[model samples]
Target: MNFTTQRIEDIVVFTLNETKLDANNSGLVKAEFTLLMKLESVKKLIIDLTDVESCDSTGLSALLVANRLVHANDGDVCLVTSSEKVLSLIRITQLNKVLSVFDTLTDALQELKSK
Candidate 1:
């Protein structure tokens, strides 16, 4: 699997298992995540990119789709990653202002909980 998901209470966390989130698998990522958003019980989502070494535009698009879905459902979404490359791409694309990003899984979860 490209990612593993664990749901605790109302928050769902997706831990990417792939090293690169590029065109090849971004569609799969988007499709699966979209389905998660439809789960009415899910109130928040945390995407953990700890294993993702890099990402492309398509990967970023997938993230955006998740964000939109969450918001449409009146929920929140957060990202957890330590990759400088991924973080840089997010900044360059000006998505940093749109998405909440954290350095650790704990931080993301805590922020989501507090919100």
Candidate 2:
């Protein structure tokens, strides 16, 4: 998966460039995100999935695990989901209630800053 990371002041913004986030690419996502979360000063995270095509259970699990880690550090993960398929998966898994999802990356960043 292709990705880029930037800090929105204290919050980090991770934008996915890939069209898919499945088992084949979920591991990379987890590793990259885990590394970012290790920063002591980092707090909130905004995951931009505007270009994401689909997400599988493994991808969802990776995101959930990352969210948990962020929460443990008094931070949170806000997802910018533009993919219907991904949103459907989250809905089916009842993860939408557990994770904060936004329609745009800007909205996600705003929510993160508010927190």
Candidate 3:
């Protein structure tokens, strides 16, 4: 898996260490998220996409699904380091307003904590 997850306080921090977030890596990302959500008190999530190079609708859908899942659990999702291309796609798709995006991990974490 090109993704990894660790806990920091009450948040589940998902770090993407891959160049692509296309279909090939979406499953891995989804599975790791499933595993992380199983843990208790994980009411906040930070997705670090600093290394992600590309994303399709499928990958973006996965993120929305994750966000929905988190919200269902009374939690929220924060996006970190969204590349310019990804950010553009997000804006065009109106997903930028849907997801909580941050330019840095610290900002993401602080946003999560504030919620």
Candidate 4:
């Protein structure tokens, strides 16, 4: 559940500071991330997952909720991660098609900023 929040222009970036993203903290992630999206100034989200080396189904579910929340608000959400394991899970679950994945925070920030 430990993370950092920062605003760069209209994008609200949430940097997950945990290594394992699982059921134990997914609910918290869902809650905090949704709260951030409710801010009127937040038009997009970049979830920096550089510290998150692993993820589970519940974690992906939390991510899905974040995605839906952003879209519901007419905003966008992108996942920024260099972890192959996390990317593999997203691919295996076919979430890579649904979620925007970036290899680095810089890439995600740049792309989301342009949108």
Candidate 2: stretches off by over 4 Å: none
Relative to the unseen true structure, what is the Cα RMSD of model 4?
Answer: 1.1
TM-score of 2: 0.93
Clashes of each: 0, 1, 0, 0
lDDT by residue (tens digit), candidate 2, 1-115? 5799888688888888988888898998888877777765456888888999798998898888778878888878898987889999999999989889999988887888887
Candidate 1 clashes between residue pairs 3 or more apart in a chain or in different chains: none
> In angstroms, how far off is 104's CA in candidate 1?
0.4
RMSD, one per candidate, in order: 1.1, 1.1, 1.3, 1.1
Over 4 Å off, model 1: none
Per-prediction TM-score to the true structure, in the order listed: 0.94, 0.93, 0.91, 0.94
- The prediction achieving the highest lDDT against the true structure is 1
Tens digits of lDDT, candidate 4, 1-115: 6899988887888999999899999999999976776655456988888999999999999999988888888888899988999999999999988878999888998998889
Q: Which model is ahead, 1 or 2, in terms of TM-score? A: 1
Cα lDDT, all candidates = 0.89, 0.85, 0.82, 0.88
Residue pairs whose backbone atoms clash in candidate 2? 19-53
Estimate the overall C-alpha local distance difference test score of candidate 1: 0.89
Q: What's the CA error at residue 72 for candidate 1, in Å?
A: 0.2
Taking the tens digit of each residue's C-alpha lDDT, what string does model 3 give over 6-112? 88877888898987787987887777677667765567888899888788887887788788878889888998865898888888998878888888899998887
